[model samples]
Target: MRAPALSALDIHLFQEGTHSRLHDKLGAHALPAGGVRFAVWAPNAAQVRVIGDWNFWAEGDAMTPRTDGSGIWEADCPQAAPGQAYKYRIVTPSGELLEKADPFAFQSELAPATASRIWAGTHTWADDAWMRARATRNALDAPMAIYEVHAGSWQRENGEFLGYRELAHRLAHYVKDLGFTHVELMPVTEHPFYGSWGYQTTGYFAPTARYGNPEDLMYFVDHLHQQGIGVILDWVPSHFPTDPHGLARFDGTHLYEHADPRQGFHPEWNSAIFNYGRHEVRSFLLSSALYWLDRFHIDGLRVDAVASMLYLDYARGPGQWIPNAHGGRENLEAVHFLQALNRAVYREQPGAFTVAEESTAWPRVSRPTEMGGLGFGMKWNMGWMHDTLRYLREAPVHRRWHHHQLTFSLVYAFTENFVLPLSHDEVVHGKGSLIHKMAGDAWQQFANLRALFGFMWAHPGKKLLFMGGEFGQRREWTHDGELEWWVTGLPGHRGLQQLMRRLNRVLTEEPALHAFDFGPEGFEWIEADDAERSVFAFLRKGPPGTAPILAVSNFTPVPRENHRVGVPLAGAWQELINTDAGEFDGAGWGNLGGARTVPVPSHGRAHSLVLTLPPLSTIYLKGPTRATNA
Candidate 1:
């Protein structure tokens, strides 16, 4: 039997599990002979046939299995052409026919319609300058404030979803004006259920046709790239939905998933986990990761639910999971797969990065695989987000008792290359909006939000704020409607929006705020022990010769007069940002623009500044040296 003309190297890599470019060989490839070559892996199939528009949807064209017992079936159809819909018809040992969508399909019929389409086109990317500068832009010390967005819900026109082409222009302008460095899109992969929010992906390769075609999505990325905004895709590689046309039960066998339900099923999500032990499956997933970087020019991938992948007993109880060979709960195969994935992405896609949404105390999550780590560029600082929000949710009177929550994150702040994410997960499922999470009256709530954001920006880490949060969105996020854009016209909300815009500008412009975010040298405590006043102060440092900035926050509603905060050097200090400024709809109490330092040692510093601290406010002060003031 003549198998598909796969090279010896490709076969070896597929079997040994190191091939990351399976897209070149699998699925439907347009042949130069006015036809297409189709290949699928159905090891347990008794017979496989190609049934599509070219074949009049009949099973007359049977595929030949590889002579080397690789379980891959292939066929060359001279009559099959691009833009035709197709599916694999496999006859199982039980004599039952199973039809499935192509796993590597580049395009598919819009959801509720599952047939894969023969799509072939190359996008003309015009972001060469952006691509070349990405390495410097994404470096560890550079500013990276991500604006997280759900494409379908971010904006709509006349109650209908805007196509990617439209979003390209709109989103690019908004993010650019707001001073965000990157835009992280929620999954855009094709999914059958809109409620899943593209998480339960059915098409790993196809961009959801809900937002126009694949090329439209490419255009969207290119537009953003040209506008100096990096695009990061939220990729889900942990599990897949068990749709009939998806990877589940392919070839009437558990070809892609584990045969054992104990290891295959995700109880929480009701999804099927990949059989990471399989070399071919590893290659398939790796290829999917690279496909985005190679074809779509994606800047990075934020891998979802990594904790679930790291542990075999995740979301499971006793007797429901199988231990690894070493009798541990860790999924060794999944670990190897993740390492391989990170290695492949870095090796193939220069200036691209990967982030892990891991919630556990998984050590070395952002460290390199060569050092026995997961090798991601960053990891979500879930602990910080939870603890900080938990503290802010309490009234100022009770915040003192929970003061450790505000200070706990700093204990391990630099453990990983962290991104303090205020992601969609925090504002959904009754958790309430970020503004609503603050505990107080309407005015106090807005002040608390402004203070929280100021503190977050001043903290040592990269930042990511979800859509709507910047404008003081009062409603919880729903994947169905637009953000509370109207709130931007209101005084408090509008001020909050302006405050955030200025915060982004400060975060990007102040080298002391972003430089060395991953190390302790960039951060130092000025007065972390001031819990009685519910006030916190810290210092952020830049390069050796650059001056440092001091951040002070007053969580209580009562204003403090003659608030003495330590300074490293003796000179004039200016208020850079005051959350209570009149422009931010606060009472406008401030230090009359600037203050001179006194020669009084405090908090281990030789000089101190006696300044008025506004109620429920946070202030950023740059000083201690005339150079910084100048």
Candidate 2:
């Protein structure tokens, strides 16, 4: 290793937490003299030493601390080289000795091992075209149907996991064929426990080695970009697991987390909460976010459990949690940190954005920071998911009494940019599959599931569906096993899969469904109060001149013949999709391919059409573009 070399300004910025790329200056950096320079931040350490394979895991020389008292130590060794396993041995101020892995390591040995590996290779990317046009492709007005996946459980070969390169081809082709615009991966960062589903992150800088090397994961993102599919990584900033080698206690103190247990310890997950008020800790998280976007070319980040970070008393009862300085439950420091994080992310990677998994009615989460908001691009609509699921799980006969649950979400749907997510969370923890959530026999369950997908696609929001949801998998999701791939061969499951493909095709091809997802002007209710019949009908409009598409749903198993519904214009209307058609294992009921509007006034409209309402299904009809009989 060589001697520490940094300007006074670099030290000041790092100390003040303004340095966004601390990885470049810290960790094991290559030296020009055919050696390596290593540095670590251990403020409470009396002395720090570099212990690695080069020194046979023995400490050779003590690293020099910054004279300015920045608490940083550095050294250069001629014996150190790339691919060497290394760690820092620190002598704390209390004279206690401890060894820890590098916090900014770009690579690490696979699990059952905790040593950091020296890596310096950079990946070459061929996705300039995708990068340039990403803004337009990810615009709020454009179509975005995401398929959420857990990498390790997405598929297994011979009961063994597939590498990133192999899964890249497999996952990309599958997503493209399904007509999805993006794939939201569950956390892929390194964590020791396989059951955490990558949420208990230990290596913020390293991609998990269970899949492949860092470059191989880069290839996965690049290949997906080439296929016109954006990739969104699930990022956890709420808290981290208290693994010994992680950021729990460094330098014999709680440097990264809170020193106070009331504020630091997370009771629900048995993890440690980050001290967002600390400058160094905030800089650490900001740098980690940038590292993934800069090195891996990720399109976006789905911030997990943001509500947990915004509240001091989250999941805690009275007297169990400490109040903020203002005597309120709000965590002001974390709010500021999140605002800064969003600002930095958009500034560094233009066109890339973030999503918040905030479950509360926190106002303006997706609004811009300058507008006094959290500044996320969109938010997962947990309210919609919960309310709709609750309503669907009830028996059809009881739906009328609880009909408002289905319509209540529209009242606040446009308050923030929303993504209607039927995510992995819904299918896990004994919740059963989406289809199983429906209350009915085999035939009605399939119909209800298809109807749910049709309604969700037509709703005023972006879309996200978890893996195995396209085809109806009856079992709950488990990290140890792959999805029931054999179920797709079954007739009912295959039909549901086909219905999903068609729904995605129509959602993308028809601008009326996506153009104004965030504004009320895009949606018009023709008959939302028909709770007695458990039926709903609405019109989805595009820009001012474009035609509208009419959607009608029946929650009951009894089909309605000659069901009169309002139409905007008197002309031919094409049947775009029918969830109850025989192809999707439905009762082969539909409007003989098209319907015509009559002069008879109905449902507050000048023109109307008598339609066949299929049992427990939804049908989408495209109205004529030309105006007639105003």
Candidate 3:
């Protein structure tokens, strides 16, 4: 929890007293007329000040020292009573100027929309009853077949943007009927331009006006929650893009960023990174993390680009970035910010999750904060998706990919809490639609997707399918366009959507599908290779008795009769769901099988299974059932 070795430049400002300074001086930041009481923890500053547009960028001497003798700055300003604009300006011993976002402000107004109106986000969450009884960290019991969507492109009409409320009803039906347990929207915060896809966000507090206002987002989340669907927002605190009209140069300078370019800009993203080195910045970012969890009742944060946040020069290629002040290649400020964000969010909302979309080997994303980890509840399994998809696309003949490509996830599937994301990025910018990624024509494309999804369900992780992938979008996604809803005329598309819904519902019923959501106990590899026939078989474990749903997939076109993959000797397995069940317009590759024990050879001993797997399809075979196939 200590700051990195401060450079002569980093310690430009230093102060003392961790708790009392801001609390006592700012009246404990008590909210007047039903407002929020704000407080920040900055254990390394001599003096702290509040600044913002409403205050006209004037640094107030209001930042007093904390009484805890921990060097934390204290300020409980009453400025948010009517929801005015604000920021932070602190002076270090060396007289450097640092401007950071309000550590506890519920909303941040972007530079273009600097003047903010902060109303208390007080509402009657009748679902509070549900929230209280909600299972903690139970991605399995929680029904999490999330639909990854970018709000801006999800829908639009007549040059008028679709507000949050509009999206709630529309997307609700789409996702609900699609059988997804949740809807995950990309970052909605106020950002510049529609190009960055909200990744290069500048305003940490404001809801992006491109969609609608703050309440609109809250209403959207509320509606989704009411529909028994969880809402997860993509949050970006790892870095902020350099947009002159946004936070990059607010108050006539890059005050929110580091003064030196070495510690300021991210060359790969062309953005300005935060100085996590500053205590005020830490408070600002942590408070933003708490704001979403507290006010919006958001189930989780799908933290974007964590790799960029954790590394100083990630994706920098050759000479695109500068070294940190500590002579290390990593952005330590970002590391601490993520840690603090997790700590604050967990402390404030125990079950609230912080998920990172990180693609690196930075360990412990799901580890406890006290253990020198990033403290995320889950991290996206990017390696799994990339390698799996590549294997799918390159192996048109099913023999090109090595056995490792098909079964490599077992090496790290249980490494941390992971969610398998077939994100929007994969379907756009010439990447082609998820269906188009298949090697065949339209029908085969849909079948390939069906096969892929069957594999996804069988894999040991929570699932996320992009918006259009469900309905068989053939072309890449476009922001200015609607998801070819017109394509419903095509059978390939309809079948895909139907399969998605069926899979989602079935996933909920079968615990084995998502039991590996958090811990290692949920998943086990039943069979890694059937390489002789280009097929793979695995088992998913949920809560016991509820455990053991055999996932059998045939990657090749040549049908294999009596495809006897060894399943656990737990009991008789039932053919629960088949991807090729004609319902999805597949070849109907499954045969009605009851739990009839059959011995099969494997890596070591004779493994036994009571299931029949068909070619180029997926079947969720539930454990030992006395019932026979109808």
Candidate number of the best lDDT: 1
User: lDDT tens digits, residues 254-340, model 3?
Assistant: 546776665677766777878777665565566566667777788888888888778776766556567778777888767776786
Each model's lDDT comes to 0.91, 0.89, 0.67
Candidates 2 and 3 compared: the better one by TM-score is 2
Please list the Cα RMSD from the true structure of every candidate, rounded to 1 decimal place.
1.9, 1.8, 6.7
Per-residue lDDT tens digits for candidate 2, residues 329-432, read 99999999899899999999998889999999988999999998999999999999999999889999999998888888889988999999999999988898
Model 3 scores what on Cα lDDT?
Answer: 0.67
List ranges where model 1 is wrong by over 4 Å. 1-3, 624-630
Error of 2 at 426 (Å): 1.2
Model 2 misplaced stretches (Cα beyond 4 Å) = 1-6, 626-630
Q: How accurate is candidate 2 locally (lDDT)?
A: 0.89
Provide the TM-score for each candidate, comma-separated. 0.98, 0.97, 0.81
| Deviation of model 3 at 269, angstroms | 1.8
